[model samples]
Target: MLTKYPTPKKLAHANLSKLTEILWNSSNGRFGEWKAQELKNLAHDSFGVENCEDIYSMALLTMLDEIQSLAEKADELEKKISSLLKNFDSTITSVPGIGPILDACILSEIGDVTRFRSADKLAAYIGVDPSVNQSGEYTSDHTRLPLPAKSRLDGLCCCCAA
Candidate 1:
């Protein structure tokens, strides 16, 4: 789709039916008439960009290609990581909402939990353990809490959230 109409002006002024057919065909019929109209409207709205057709466009195009290549490599790396993670009996992977890639990355970072003396040490290492406030013989238990926001709507308001 971009190859056919790389410039905003060309896309904005393109014949409606032709653009729709190209978009439809390019997307294998997934993007139809509505998407074409949307793109056309978007192109019309974003005009007077000289760089779109200049030497900057070539650089932009090259960067886009590089991004696509990097994305493919990342996906491949993720699959390899997931496969590698299966060899270890990780409790992290057993937890709800935790996936293989994340577990693999975390396990790689915090290798061999036995190295930490205790669970508290692990928690402190990960920066989750809270610090206690103490001074000489006086130990403070009070923790500062966030102030409640002012009520935008009083009891007279119709909505519950408001």
Candidate 2:
């Protein structure tokens, strides 16, 4: 991008049509267009942040370290789940567009696949089955409202989307 606009200020004020073409590509577009317009506005208004270096305080850095540690823990758990999934011979992952993590999650929720007589039964158990919204006066098309019995709501989206 620097080949076209060499400086931050020059790129900052680049015309909207050209900027969108360049940015793949706000205010009206808000994140005010990915904070670029906000930057431009700040520059135009001569706005400045005081004591920006204070952002690097020990408290923020400690939280960042904790976040990194948690991320690593999550990755470890994901790998463990993927490994555990291999013991089950079910072809749940054979469904296109679904991945091992989702397959593992849905399978873990449904413990024994053989318990369900058919695919429809499995889908219903996973909270993906749509139910009629009807009263004496009105009825709406089938909508998926998560069953109170089912604690994991993510299954609704994963099953339907898959």
Q: Which candidate wins on TM-score?
A: 1
Among all candidates shown, the one with the greatest lDDT? 1
Task: Please give, for residues 1-162, the per-residue lDDT of candidate 1 as tens digits.
Answer: 665576777788888899999988888999988988898899999957575566655666677789889999999998998888878878885665567766775676667888999998765665445666678998789643222122221211112223
Instruction: Report lDDT per candidate.
Output: 0.70, 0.63
Query: Which regions of candidate 2 deviate over 4 angstroms?
Result: 1-56, 127-162
For residue 109, model 2's alpha carbon misses the true position, in angstroms, by 1.6
Question: After best superposition, candidate 1 residue 36: deviation in angstroms?
Answer: 4.5
Tens-digit lDDT track of model 2 for 23-133: 452133434244556545554565334355244344456676798799999999888987887888868678776667777766666788788899877667766666778
Q: In model 1, what lDDT does residue 53 have?
A: 69
Q: Which stretches of candidate 1 lie over 4 Å from their true place?
A: 1-4, 15-58, 94-98, 135-138, 142-162
My TM-score estimates for the predictions, one after another, are 0.58, 0.50
Worst lDDT window (10 residues) for model 1? 152-161
TM-score of 1: 0.58
